[model samples]
Target: MSVYTQLTNDQFATFCQSFGVSFVRAIPITQGIKNSNWFIQTTDDVDGAYSYVLTLFEERPPADIEKMAVILNQLDGKLPVAAPLSVIESNSVQTDDDDKRYVIHYEDKAITLVPCLAGSHPEQTTQAMCHDIGAALAMLHETLQALQPAEQYGVPLYPWADVRDREMQFMPGDEAKLMSDIWRSYTELPLTTLPNGLCHLDMFADNTLWNLQKGEEHLTGLLDFTEVSVEHYVMDIAITINDFCTTWGMAEQGESVNFDRSKMAAFLQGYESKRALGLDEKRALPVMLAKAAVIFWLLRLNVIHYNRTEGRTGDNIMVKNPDLMKRLAAYHWAHVEKSQNTVFVLSGTTSDNQIIGVFSSITQAEQAREKLSNSSEFAIKEYTLDQLS
Candidate 1:
């Protein structure tokens, strides 16, 4: 997380009083990458010591950031979301106009205070936790699908075309070629009939909070709504699975990246429990996974460029390793190359289709086939994947 704009304790205290809040302390939050965040402590006569998260919109348009309040308001009681708080204005009283949003002008930058969500990011996610996260995302999408016409969320999908070009100049030959191939595969893929709606396009592990009880972990909350926009539900699922199911191994310590099959299984199980994936979505998932990896790889490369060009360091910059995204893209593309990547589905003429598994290798497919051989009404078939020519 980066704090581009600095605020003194006195400045914070005065700002707190505008909402009838007395400041106690502020601690910089170093987990976020796109925006500045601070953990705020406050006290008042009615409520004793309380905590909140103070945020400054760095890259997002202020108007879009303000619209987040509306989205959060929609999700307040429905999900484990930390909605923005309204600050009192004019003689310490709050009204409709005065409380349009929690956002305020701080040094000419947009800032908002939201309740600090419970739980913390899990260092390593388990299959069960992945399941919980999957269910939560399904609920998030289902709830948002009602808000129609794409105008509700004023944000657009990341301009991958423009970003890919800008960052490719700095990339090496192999990396650049890989990026170009993935971009071509992504843009040429058919997405016209995919289920589209408002989606949290970035569902990285760090953005989710979890509570470990006894021996199992439960997904308690979600963060970072800045990237929410209208997109394909399948694409949203791909973004999340790439982050939650993949194990970077000791990669942070210079090892290898691996995707966990069991974790992916559990995640898909939970997601289907809420909303089952259609045939077209299942067919598109593998390529979508690769595309998701490509998007983040390029975006993080851009983030590195921004941080370095401005001579930014420390809490003023939050940069993720674009290399990991590269490795992830490579891994998924290798599977795509193996050909006919799709989830397990029964396609016999006399029976209802049910997705039972997803794999890249034929041996795994054979094993699944053997298991289903006992049932005469079930048959395994290659998915009719529409890859870009």
Candidate 2:
């Protein structure tokens, strides 16, 4: 059975008391791909008065948890992120009636508490925000290039290039092949050289939060470091762009939504502002984006889809928007090809077919390139159609 489970009011209150906090109420927060989270209110009366977010770490071991926390704490000082908080002098959230560690025992499982961060997740991406996110990611990659950790945590045992290799073991045949091919092509593209760092491997839209004040939203908090790993920084960027920038008709219809390119630019601008990309990185952006798409595609196929086939409720979002998983995979393939050609034909004007191959619309691609040229902060050297092969 899947690991997600809910804590009753009594269990929540008792858990709070053990942590030297008085609980007033508790509400169910969204369950992530790995952990089940809850927002607990406390009588502490502090500005960010919430006690903490409760996460049940079912799949990850204690050592993995410790490593993730340590890596994130190191990165938090340098980036805009909310790292995990360790429970001092205790192995569990509470001791049970049978003298078992409630949080550590099978019933509570690998439960943990993290300080709540104040912010809302961005429903849509903007160019400015994308820039900030890009810059932050670049800076993170640069910083991570230097630091070496005591131990490697959550490194993929199998080749990440093929999603099928991993999922086929659990799911059999052509269905698996389709999933794997989509992921392999998207993730395995050669783009910017890989630089090692403590990467937040799971940087989806919901995991990142935006602080709102006076009706304006700014990037504030990044959450859920459970999938934290030692990997390439570009991987994170690819994942964010693939998930947030692309529009899935099925997913949108189910959730009631539309696409916003301005938001995409906002995030990219934010990321680029902090850590400027070289020609290599820029040229490789689409391939990287494809790699990111494949990771989430597999995540949905393996975890979310697997659950639904077995008749489960833990992943309502995936279950509700089944078509999204397929649409995302298709979109990534289309964009990766476009980005690769665009980078190749940078110096001279490109033919309509070549431009179309890389970008969904030639006009939109041209506009994007033009915008990059006009922006004093971010300037891209022009490429003509004739020069592109």
Candidate 3:
């Protein structure tokens, strides 16, 4: 991510020696917010100039870093993962005795060197690219099915409660309520029935690399597995769709964000080509999309909070706008209400109360409630098809 720990070129050159490469240059990459990254250039006798990405883990523990390295290694040939280069065993003599196979310790921080992937991050996403990414993501999920359990790798579940207590509490009343509503909607879904596996939670276009050829863009690489964890497949899909299928800066036109349905369809088509989604996952998608947006909104807000309180400031620190994500979350909820695909069940408060009527639209359910006796209180409960199951 961002350049938090500054390193001199001489320091970089010294570090690169362990990998048996002559360091040419180390340029700070100032795009992300989690770790410190550098675009390193190295010279070899056979390959004059080759590029690699040098990453310095700013916050992760050694075990976390090691797990990431192992995961990347597992996915290396199967996908275009940026697998870290193993430290030359002979070079261990030059460094410390507590040597890792792929990772090195420098300045008490975990560091890794991965070959720079070819192609550039797509400036704009296309349907074809969406399809490719979706298919690739699905394939990635299937490939990791045989891997050990999430806990075995020390991968933690999504911190829904943590975000609610830490970030949402400090948010404005309206925004906090929106978050709570969306979270409740998500929690009510049949989450256990949804497919689960390793998921790249952050699959934004910028995290992927693409190459343009003959007017069509093809996915060349998928970058950044730092946020990868064991999560619902639908959750991963929702996160990806929120990014690839969303058009930013449309607030001036009217809506805060616009969802390109055609692109979303193409992406799902590609995903289904590799692995089909259960009907439950499809039904849960709308709410999950809103939930995904809320998570990112809170994440960005958290970043801003730390940057201000922790006093992390510099040209290398890149902070994304949280308001955009908040607006997107609102738009998703509006979309859900307007679509009216969810079922509404109306019931009375009496002890002998039974399900009176199930309506497709909330308006219809409200009308039915109005016609009923006002003496017995009524409540409209929303449910997705999966929830009924």
Candidate 4:
């Protein structure tokens, strides 16, 4: 609920006129954390009705917003993302630009408008819904392949280092130490080999709107592209799985967060339905989970530390409990390096065959699988159990 800049109806009407969209009424959208948003109900010259989300980009740099517009432009027709609308030309007819500011100045802040995709965020995220979002994300990642990765398209890692250097005020000492440990181990992961590309790093349920149906799930609207960036796809996967699949009631701020393993499997299956996850990706996922946890932990902490007076008046701030992320980070870090893998030997042509035995490590599992790969009509595979259930 961050609306740092306010606009009057007359001001909004003038702004809408530039885009050849008439302003009917405006309602402030206060669900977002980073930027100020408003649902503008508009009427064209012909009395045609439409709605758009007007966003004043805060926190992020102007250049990042430019690249974000480019990404949204590329994904306009391919996915359910709410892309920004261009301002009508001086003639008030056609509007086109290559790399100009689709973003305009409002109170010296960069702002843009996008069509409001219709759908409500699910009250309770179903396994089927998780599956739908997983596939949608993969499709989004696939379509985003066309865009070149740029510096501003990613959240820089150096900030983590800076965050570490800052003196702790409210954070528990042991929790802070655990976070440092995870970040240290995260840097040692095989980051170079993992699939890296443009990712919607933040895919929590609220960011997505769904077409809800009995025994069916459909993704209708994907919002808040501000957090999209260039990063390892597995990291994105980890972030989504943690947010969507995990559901324990918020007892306090962050006390009851728990990951559901069945939903995790279902989500991975759905993701693989569009794009396959390789063994390298699988192996790196645990640490990537830790990385996702740390990133969000630091992000929330940074926000709370800086914007202390965010929601003191009208609306309450949706402060995501950093402790929950901290807890998950420590959990993943503990399991990531554990020596717990199982080797499987298959009969016939199917992968659902027989597990030979549980090996202590992936290396040992590989050795056992290799010994039987040459056996008469048998397939071999290694499955790492990076403890998440």
The residue-by-residue lDDT of candidate 3 on 1-389, one tens digit each, is 68999889888987787766679888788887888998887764234445788989887765677787777877889888888877887734555423457778876788888888888877678888888988999998888776777656536765667867898767789999899999999999998899888888999988998887746788888888877788899999999989998977644665456677667867887788899878688778888889999999988987888789999998889998888889889988886766565788888877876788987655346546755668249888877765554
lDDT of 2 by residue, 203-321 (tens): 66677778755346576777776676666566677677665665545433674333344555555566666765554555455555545655555666666655656565633232334
Model 3 gets an lDDT of 0.80
Q: Which regions in candidate 1 have their CA more than 4 angstroms from the true location?
A: 44-50, 91-99, 250-252, 340-389
* Alpha-carbon lDDT, every model: 0.76, 0.56, 0.80, 0.72
lDDT of prediction 2: 0.56
Could you give candidate 1's per-residue lDDT for residues 212-260 as a string of tens digits? Answer: 6747677778888888898899899999999899877664668567788
Question: Candidates 1 and 2: which is better by lDDT?
Answer: 1
Question: Which structure is stronger by lDDT: 1 or 3?
Answer: 3
RMSD after CA superposition, every candidate: 5.6, 7.0, 10.3, 6.1
Evaluate residue 18 in candidate 3 and report its C-alpha lDDT on the 0 to 100 scale. Answer: 73
TM-score of each: 0.84, 0.71, 0.82, 0.81
Best by lDDT: 3
lDDT of 2 at 160: 48
Clashes of each: 1, 44, 0, 0
Instruction: Determine which window of 10 residues in candidate 2 has minimal summed lDDT.
Output: 353-362
Tally clashing residue pairs in candidate 4.
Answer: 0
* Model 2 per-residue lDDT at 21: 59
Pitting candidate 1 against candidate 2, the one with the higher TM-score is: 1
Rank ordering of all candidates by TM-score, starting from the highest: 1, 3, 4, 2
Candidate 3 colliding pairs: none
